[model samples]
Target: MERILVVGVTGAGKSTLARALSGRLDLPYRDMDALYYTGREWAVNDDLVATVSRLADEPRWIVDSLGYPEVRDLLWDRADTVVWLDYPRHVVMPRVLRRSVRRTVTREVLFGGNRETWSDWLSRHHPAWWAWTQHTSRGREIAHRAADPRFAPLSTVRLRHPRDTAAWLAAL
Candidate 1:
């Protein structure tokens, strides 16, 4: 597929899948977190809609995002396919916790020169907590969007398990 959108809750492996798909499909990869963040702060481009709309006009690209409310419609309208990582909470929570721990321990730099810290991991706004609380709601939202008639042109591949995701990527 050409314009692909990888969507899921935080720590659901959207970035990982998008990167792999970009390499396999020979499409450029973009992460919304990088675009929206600036040095550990939320600093969206001045004209976010225009910027994203312009990016969507490109011939080929794969994007990973949390489906920000402001740009969800734009992304859905532009994407020819959506890869939804819909792993269950039981599968996702531990992964998120481990990822947070590893990032914190390693001081791994992330988008916008940000690094996860133990204190940040324990914060209410932590990615692990976000994923735990938003897991079901995010899945439902993606499913609904994928089924919507307005987005009929967009196809979706929903992978409910980590193994399913692996198989799907292998088959690609």
Candidate 2:
């Protein structure tokens, strides 16, 4: 489907799946983090809403995010399909931990030219910590959004495990 939103809690691999779907479906792929974090030091793009709204108007796109507060409803409203990664904490925690460790150790550059540092692990914003703390809440939020009447007619593909997602993607 076009105008897809790949959504999940932190570390659920939303970006990875979205990228894969973009290639498979031949739709433009947009990483929300890249769009939101526009410069060094994670400087936020001041025109995020305007920029995202413009993208939402496009005929075909696959974005990896639940969307930032300002654009959450807009993305959901415009999306024809939503791919939800609903893996359990057992599956999510290890992924986030490994990703954070790898990024920190390799000094891998991420959105806005920012790299995860050992010190960054102390922050609540760190992926590992954020995922651990917000896992349940995020799942609830996603569930509510999926069930919301306002977003009706939006086709949803909810994957409960990594294997399920793999099979679904293969079929797609």
Candidate 3:
């Protein structure tokens, strides 16, 4: 699919799926985290909206991002297809926790040169905690978006399991 928008909770593998799709389809990929972050901080780029609008106008691209309100409408308006990774909490919590631990242990640099720390991991704002708290709410939001008549022109794919995601990608 062209102009794909991948959305999900923190650990639902949105980035992974977007990257895979980009590679398979020979399309460019953008991770919204990288666009939203600056060196070690969450600073919005002054040109963020315009930049994304420009990308959205492209013929083909894969964008991976959480459904942040600021740019949600902009991206969704341009996306021909939306991929929602709707894996359950039981399936995603461990994935997020392990990812957090691994990133912290390995000192992997994330977007904006930020690295995960044990202290941050324990914080309420941690990705894992965010995922746990927002899981159901996020699912409801995606469902609402899918059912909205305004988005009628868009095709939405909701994957409820990891295996389902794999199969969808394979079929693609």
Backbone clash count for every predicted candidate, in the order shown: 0, 0, 0
**lDDT (tens digit, per residue) of candidate 2 on 49-115:** 9999999999999999999998999999999999999989999999999999999999999999999
Model 3, residue 36: displacement in angstroms? 0.8
Candidate 1: list runs displaced more than 4 Å.
Answer: none
Of candidate 3, the 10-residue stretch with the lowest lDDT total is 36-45
Clashing pairs in 2: none
Pick the winner on lDDT between candidates 1 and 3. 3
Residue 31 of model 2, lDDT score: 96
Better of 1 and 3 by TM-score: 3
lDDT of 2 at 154: 90
Reference-based TM-score, model 3: 0.94
Residue-level lDDT of model 1, residues 116-164, one tens digit each, is 8877867778998899888888888888899998987888998989899
Instruction: Give stretches of model 2 more than 4 Å off.
Output: none
Q: Per-residue error at 56 for model 2, in Å?
A: 0.4
Per-model TM-score on C-alpha atoms: 0.93, 0.98, 0.94
Sort by lDDT, best first: what order?
2, 3, 1
- Superposed Cα RMSD, model 2: 0.7
